[model samples]
Target: MAKLKDKRREKISVATEIDRLEERRSRCQDNLERAEFRSRKEKLTEKERQELEDEMAIMNERVQKLNKELDTLRGENRKNMLLSIALLAISAFFYYIFFYNEEDP
Candidate 1:
């Protein structure tokens, strides 16, 4: 119930975060490519090159963190699914014991 809703919300949040990180990474790569193109055409100042490298590093780190978070969410979902199946099986066993016995000789 409440736990299920919480898991769903967390899954959505993780997915959103992954999407955002991916978008940021794409933008950063595009900027890096533009800087490289400019450098080839003329020359990039040391500061500009350093800034581009720094931006790329930061974006890469963020994307890696987001990927890890997505993996964790997937693991949690798998665990929850397994737990639910076990609980359902246990409940059914108890139900059979309580009801099926009554119908037997």
Candidate 2:
């Protein structure tokens, strides 16, 4: 029973983590787009341009990292789902075998 609660908690935590990471990734993408538009639409000093470029690079790296993390989390979630399904199937099978005697009409 304790293990079941722990597993449920872990699953919820992973889902929450995935949601948080997705939000971060969305924000990063939005910032990156704005940066790109600013670079293309405005005239700026060399220093300003260099700074923007650096910022964009950092944002790009962050977005990549977030994407990788999200992928890993999603994969883990899939594995957990499969495991749960298998466990349920096994439990049902055992229950049927041991507790589900059929009555003849």
C-alpha lDDT (0 to 100) for residue 48 of candidate 1: 82
The models' CA-based lDDT, in order, is: 0.71, 0.93
Quote the positional error of residue 81 for candidate 1 in Å: 1.3
Instruction: Tell me the tens digit of each residue's lDDT in model 2 across 1-105.
Output: 999977876767788989989999999999999999999999989999999999999999999999999999999999999999999999999999877866657
Highest TM-score against the true fold, candidate: 2
Please report the TM-score between candidate 2 and the true structure.
0.83
Q: What's the C-alpha lDDT at position 104 in model 2?
A: 53
> What are the per-residue Cα lDDT tens digits for candidate 1 across 23-69?
76577567657656665686668998788667767756765675676
Please list the residue runs of candidate 2 whose C-alpha ends up more than 4 Å from where it truly belongs after superposition: 1-12, 102-105
lDDT: which candidate is best?
2
Against the true structure, candidate 1 reaches a TM-score of 0.55
Q: Please count the clashing residue pairs in each candidate, in the order shown.
A: 0, 0
